[model samples]
Target: MRIIPREEWGARHGDGRYWTTLPASEVWLHHSVTVAPDTVPPWTDDFEAIRTIERIGAQRFGSVYGFPYTFGITPAGLIFEGHHIAKTGAHTYGHNTIGRAICLVGNYETDEPTELQLDAVAWLLRHGQAQGWWREARLDGGHRDLTATACPGRHAYAAIPRINARATQPIGGGGASPSTGGAQRRYLQEESTMQLQPGKHGQYRSIPDGATRVIVGCPHGQMSARIIWHGPGYPSTHDMDTRWPDFDWVAKDAVHNTIHRLRPWRVPIPEKATGFALYWDYPPVEGHYDDYTGEVSFEF
Candidate 1:
C-alpha cells in the first residue's frame, strides 16, 4: 500500500493534544462531498484536492474539534495521513474513540469510485492490520452505518463488503476458507419462518451450534435492522440501514433494498454463542407506511 505521509502532502499538524493512544478496533469509510473550486468540470489533482479538503475541514471543524478523520484516500489510490490515529476525530459521533475514519476523495452517490480506489482501500486496511495499528480491528463499515447521514455514498458504501473480504484474505494464501458442505448449503437454502411484527423493537432466537453466518433482511425499506449477539466481553451489534435513508419509501423495483448479511468472519460473533437477537426501529408514523417484516437466515 502506498501511503503518502502528511509531510509529503504539506499538511499541518494539530495542537499536540490527543484524545487517547489506543489502537482503533473499527474503520469507518466516508466520501468527501465537496467538489473542486473552479474548473470546467470541477476536477483537481489529488494533492491539491486533499489539501483543499483539509483546509476546509480545519475551518469548519478545527475550531472545536481536530480534523474529522485519521486518513483520506485520493482518486488515484494514494492514501494521505490526516489527523494522527491517537487523537479522537469528530468523524462519527459516539464512535470517534474506537473508529478510524478514512474519507474517499469524491462524492459517490451519483458517481462511482474507480476500481483502483477501492483496491487501495482494501490494501490500506490490510497494511494497518499487518502493522499492528489496528490489530484487533475486524469491523469495517461506512460512516452512515453509525450515523444518519448519507456519507460514504451508496456506490462507495456498496464496495465495503468486498474491500473487507479482500483485506481479511491471507497474506500469502495460508488461511483456510469456510467449509461449504451439503449440510451447510442446506441450512442456507432453508426458508426463514421468523416474522417481525410491526413496531417490534427486538427479537431473539437460538442459532445452530456451528452456524458461521447470519443473513438479515428487511423488505420494508423504511425501517432499520440491527443484529446483535451476546459475546464474551460485551454484546456486539451491526447496523443494517447504512446505504439507504431511514424513512425513505422504496418502490418494489428499486435496485437495492435494505439488508444486513452478517458474516461472522467479518463481524465477529462469539464462538461459544448459542442464540442471537434482531433489533429494529423506525420513525413514528400516524398512518401506515409499510408492514415491517424481517427475515434471518443462519448458515452452518
Candidate 2:
C-alpha cells in the first residue's frame, strides 16, 4: 500500500492549480499513449517512467504546473505518485476539478497491459479509498470514458472489468459499449513521414480501399504549417491552416503535451469521391521537415 512520493521521482512544484481536500470524489484511468520518441521510452525502472512523464508534462503544462495525471504505474506493479490525491489533476479537462487520473504505462491500443500492471491499479484504488485519499473511489472508467480518445486503448480498456470485478467494490459495467460505427477499421503505416519542401507540391497517399472514415492521429500543436493535412487530394488540395469541413478534427487529451502527443483528426470520405490520401499541402515557407515519419496512423 505504498505509493512512491513524487519528490522522490523529482516532480516539479505545482502553481497552486486544483488543490483539493483528501478523499476526492471520482477516479479516472488512462494509458500514457505518450508521443515524441525523444521523451517517451522504456525507462530503466518504473520510477524513471514517472520522471519521463514529469519532464514531458512539465514542458507541456509548464515547469510550474507540468505534471498532468495524478499517478503513474508500470507493467511491473509499481505505483508512483504524480500530484498527491488532494492535488486535483490537470489530467482531464472540464472534469479536472472532480477526479484524479491514474495512468497505465504502455499504449493499450496494440500493446497488452500485463497482469501485474492491472493488479497494481486495483490495489492502488482500494488503498486510496481506505487511506481517505479518495471518497470511496471506484475504477470509474478509462480516459475514453470522460472524453473522445482511443486512450487506455482497446486492449487495456477491455481489461477494466477484470480489474474492477476483483476490487473491493462490486463491479457493474464492462467499460464503454463496443462500437466501431459499422465501417471496419483501416490503418496507415505507423510513424510514416513525408517531406514538405515548403513550396513543393506537398504529398499524397491513398488510404485502404473500404475506409469510409479515417481517424488520423498527427503530432499535436504542429498543424500551423508543419505536418499539416489539407483534406483530400481533390479540387484545390486545400491548405493546412484550416481544417477540412467534413473531417472531424478531434483533439485528444492534449494541450499538455502538444509537442509529443498525436491528436486525432477524423476525416470522413465523400461518397462520390473515387480516391483519398491524407493530402499534405505544404505552405510556402523556407524549409521545414515532418520527421514524425513513423508517428502517423488511422483507425476508421
Candidate 3:
C-alpha cells in the first residue's frame, strides 16, 4: 500500500502542496483511457502513462495545480500519490472537496485489468479506510456515473465490486476502502430463476434489498429473445427508455450466442442498486428460442 510521492515521480506541479480533512466521504473511480493499454505496460515503462495524464491535466485545466486524482495506480500495481486525502484534488469537478479519486492506468473498455492492477487498487481503497482517510470510505461510483463521460471504462466500471470486496481485507493485514454502501462482501452469488413476460406492466420480480447483478440466460440459445433493464419505475417492455424498438422479450444466451458461444447475457447495472425490473422485448431479428423461454438470473 505504499504510494510513491510526486517528488519521487518527478511531478512538475508538486510545489503547492495543501491539505484538507480526514476520512473523505466519497471515492470516485477513474481510468486513464487516453493511453494505449498495450503501449508498453507500467511494469517496465515506469510512469509514462501517468506523465501523459499530468500533461493532459495541465493542458485542459491550467488552474489546477497538480494531478487531478489523489492517487494514480499503474498496471504494474504501483500507487503514486498525486493529492493526499486531506488535499483538495482536481478530479470529479465540483465533488473534489469530499471525494477522493483514484485513476487506474489504462483504458478498461478494451483492456481487461490485470490481477495485479485490481489487487493494487483494492489495497489502496482498503488502506484509505484503515488509515482513517475516510470513515466508511464510501464508493460514490465511477466518474461516468457522476458525469457525462465514460471515464472509468466498462471493464473497470464492472470491477468496482471486486475492488470493494478485496479492499474488505482486515485492517491489521493491509488497507481498506469504503465498503459498497455497507456491503462488506459483495460477490456474484446466484439467485433463483425469475420468469418475465413481454410488455407486462406492474409485472416484475422483487430482488433482494441489496444491489444485484442481472444475467439473462437463454437455455434456448441465440433465438429471438431480447430484454432490457427496467428501473424502479418499471418502464413498459416496448418503451424507448428500455432502448428497445419492438416486443422486448429476448433472452440473454440468445444475444451472446454469436460472440460468446451462448454465454449468459449480462446486463449492465448500477452498484448498490434497488428497485429494478426486467422488461422482456422482441424485435424483428431472426431466430427463436428453442424452449421459448428466457430466464433471468440474479447475482450479488
Candidate 4:
C-alpha cells in the first residue's frame, strides 16, 4: 500500500495530507455526487476525481492549506491511491474518519459505471477486509446515512450490492466457500436521513412520480427469501430514528408478505418505472416488506 502526497494529486485545494499505509477492514463501498470520465482530459485518469474532490472540499470547508485523511477515485474496478492517510481529508461527512473516502467518475443519471469501475471498488473493499480495516460484522452503508444531501447519486449507490458481491467472490484464487456465503451476504445502499410511513397490512399507498428502487436478498427462514419495496406513495421524509425500526404490522397474505427486511431500493420515475414501482405493491399485504426508500434529487 503506497501513500502519495496530495500535492502530487494535481488539482490544488487540499494537499500535504496523509492516509493509512494500508486499509483497516474488508468492507469497502463508496459514492460520488459528480463523476467525470477518466479519458476526458482535465487531469490524468479518474484520479482527477480525487483532486476535484480536494478543490470542492477546500471551497466548502474553507481549508486551502490542509489535506484530508484519505481520498480515492474509481471509474470501473481500477482503484487509484491519491493521498496519504496521515493528513485528514475534508471529504465525506468529514475529512477524518474510520472509513476511507472513495469517489467514482461519472454522473450516474447519464452514465452507468463500467464493470471495471465497479470491480475496482470491490477489490479495494476486499483489500481492506483482508487488512482487517473493515469487516463483515459492520453493515456497509451509503453516503445518505450520514448527511442530508445526495452526493453519491442513486445510479452509483444502487450498484453497491453487486459490487460487494463481486468483491467477496473469489476470482483467480479460490472463491468464497459455502460457509462464508462469499459476496451474497454483504449488501449496501445509500439511505436518506429522512423517514417515511411504515408498511401496514391490507393498506394501499402510492409511489408519487419519480423514485428509484433497490432490492437485496436478506436472510430468510428455511427454504425461503423475500423482496420489499415502496408499495404505495413515495418514501416519506421521516427517519427510522434507530439502526433498525420497530417491525410494523401487515397481513401475512399481502402481495409478497414474505418479503421482509429493508434493502436499498431505487427505481426511476418513468412510465415503465411506474409499472415497476407498483408491481411490488399491488394487492394489499402481498408486497409488504421492510426496506429503506429515498427520493433522488441529483441531476445528470
Candidate 5:
C-alpha cells in the first residue's frame, strides 16, 4: 500500500525530459524493454533496476516509460510500483487513457524473465484486485486494438486473459475455472531453472514429455520428482504465492538447493499437468549454460 511519489521515483532524463502519467481505471500489463540480465536474484528487491527503466524511457522518448500506475515484476518475485496510478504514464499511446499499466522487466524477444518476476507480477495484480482496482477495470489492449502501434508485445499481450483470470478467481476455490472445481497448474519454462514437480515415492511415473513443475526443495540436487497429478481444488500457479502456502509435497528429498555442475534440465513435467503457470527465476538456472535444461522423470 506504500507508494513512492513520482518526484522521488524519477529524475529528468539526461536529455532533460520529464516523466508522464496516466489516469488509473484498470490494471494494464506490459513487458519492460530494458533487456535485463537473466538473473536479478530478488528482482523487485533491486530498486535501481526499476528506476533505470523509467530513466531510459524518459531519455529515449522524452517521457517516462509506461504509465504511472505501471508496476513491474522483478526477477526475484517482488512487486514494484513504477508510477502513480492517478497520473499519466508514457508506456502506451492510447491505452493509457483508461488503463494503469504493469511492465515486466526483461526483453521478451531476447530473454524471458525468471520465476521471481512472474511471482512479483502476480502478487501486484492480486494486491490491486484485493484493493478493488479491477472491479470495473478493463484489461490492456493494443494501440492497434484502440488506435496504433504494436506495443505491449505479442507474448506479453497474450498473457492478459490468463493474468486477468488469475486475478479474478475466487479465493480458496482454485484456478480460472472456479465453477469446475478443477486444479490449475503453472509451468516453469525458463532456459535453465529447477522447480518442484508433483509426485511421490513408490509412484514411479513418466513425466510425459513436456510438463511444468515447481521448485519445492532446492535448485537441482536430484531430490526431484515428477508430479503425477495435482489435487483437485489446488490454486492456480499465478495465485500461488512464493512466501505463503509453501508448496507441500510427499517427496521432499528430491529438490536440491544447489547443483554441483551446471547442466540443462527440463522443468519436471508431470502427467495430467495442464495449464501450467511459470515463475520468473525462482530455481535459478545459469543462463550461459543452462538454457532449456529443466526436468525429471518418475515412472509409475
Candidate 6:
C-alpha cells in the first residue's frame, strides 16, 4: 500500500498521549464533505487539500481529542496518515478504539467518487488486515453507521459491499458476485397517528428487514423527520433537512393552503441492517409551538 506518512505532510506527533489498546475489529469509512476546486485535474493528487483538512481537524478538535481520524484519502487515491494507529482517533463516537477511520476527500452527496478512490480504500483494508493492524476486523461501514450526520453520503456508501468484496478477493482479479434469486420488489408504508407535541420527540417505528430504500412523507404537518438505523455495534440517525434533494415540498391543496405543504424525503438502507427507527421533530413556529400529526410511508 502506498501511503504518505505524517512526516511527509509535515504533521507533528502528539504529546505522547496514546489510546488504550483494543482489538481493531472494524474499518469505518467517511467522506470529508468538502467541495473540491474545479481548477484541479480529476486524478491529480492534492496534497494541499489534505493539509487543509488536517489543519481544520487540529483547529476544531485538536485540544480535546487531538486529530480526528487515522488517515485521509485523496481524490487520486493517495493515502495520507493522520493521528497514526497508536493514538485513538476522534472519528467514530462509540467505536473509536475498535475501528480505524479512513476518510475520502470529497462530498459524495453531491458528486460520485472516482474508481481509484474506491479501489484505494479496498486495498488499504486488505493490507491492514493482513498486517494484523485490524486483527479482529470483519465488517466495514460508513461513518453514518455510528453517528447522526451524513459523513459518508449515498454514492460512497453504495460502494461498501464492493469494497468489502475486493478486500477478500485477489488483487486485480474477480469482482463481487451479483445477487441471484431475484425477490419481488416490496414497499412498506406506515402513517403517523400520534401527534408530535411541541418541544417533544416522537417515538420511532421499527424498520423491517429486506428493505432497500425508504421514502418518508409527512402528509399534513411541517416537521423534520429522521431515519435511524440500528446495526449490531453502531446506530446511525440522519435528519431530513434541505440537504437531501429527495426531501422536497409536495403541494396537495387545491388553493386554500398554498404556503403549507407536505415534505417528502428518501434515504438508502445501510447494509447488514437488522432494523430501523423512524421519528419526526416539530420545531417552534413563529415563536410558538404546535402539535404535528402526520402519516409516514416506507418503500422496501
lDDT scores of the candidates, listed in order: 0.57, 0.55, 0.58, 0.40, 0.42, 0.56
List model 1 lDDT by residue over 1-300, tens digit each.
446677655565452135775567788899888662221111124555677777777787774343467787766555678777677776777877777888888888877876556666777777777776675424467888887888899998888877777667655221211122241122332233354445647776666556676555443334556655543222344347643212211112112223332111122345655555567554434463332344455555
Number of the top lDDT candidate: 3
User: What digit string (tens of lDDT, one per residue) describes model 3 on residues 1-300?
Assistant: 467778656577642235777778888899877763331111113344566677777776563556777888866556778765687877788777777888888888888876656777777776788789876643667999888998898888888887777767664333221122113323222234454332223234544554355566433223233334334443455646756433333222213323121345565555423334444442212353221334465554
The TM-score measured for candidate 2 stands at 0.52
Q: What are the RMSDs of all candidates, in order?
A: 21.1, 16.6, 19.3, 19.7, 13.6, 19.5
Clashing pairs in model 1, backbone N/Cα/C closer than 3 A: none
Q: Is candidate 3 or candidate 5 better by TM-score?
A: 3
lDDT (10s digit) by residue, model 4, range 1-300: 122344444445544344443343322234555556442111223344565665666666655423332445445233445334433445554424445555565566456776655655655555555655555422265565567756456776788777767766653332322112225211111121122223321222232333343231211121121222332233345445733222222222213334332222322233332112122321222253332221111111
Displacement of residue 294 (Cα, Å) in model 2 is 32
Worst 10 residues of 6 by lDDT: 176-185
lDDT of 1 at 10: 56
Model 4 TM-score (2 dp) = 0.44
What TM-score against the true fold does each predicted structure earn?
A: 0.52, 0.52, 0.53, 0.44, 0.44, 0.52
lDDT of 6 by residue, 196-292 (tens): 3433353544445555655543423355665555554323444567332222222221111111234345566666554454555554555433222
Candidate 5 deviant stretches above 4 angstroms: 1-23, 40-45, 61-69, 113-116, 136-138, 142-144, 170-300
Off by over 4 Å in 2: 13-16, 35-43, 169-300
* lDDT minimum window of 10 residues, candidate 2: 176-185
Worst 10 residues of 1 by lDDT: 245-254
The regions of model 3 sitting more than 4 angstroms off are 14-19, 36-44, 172-300
Give candidate 4's root-mean-square deviation (CA, Å).
19.7
* Candidate number with greatest TM-score: 3
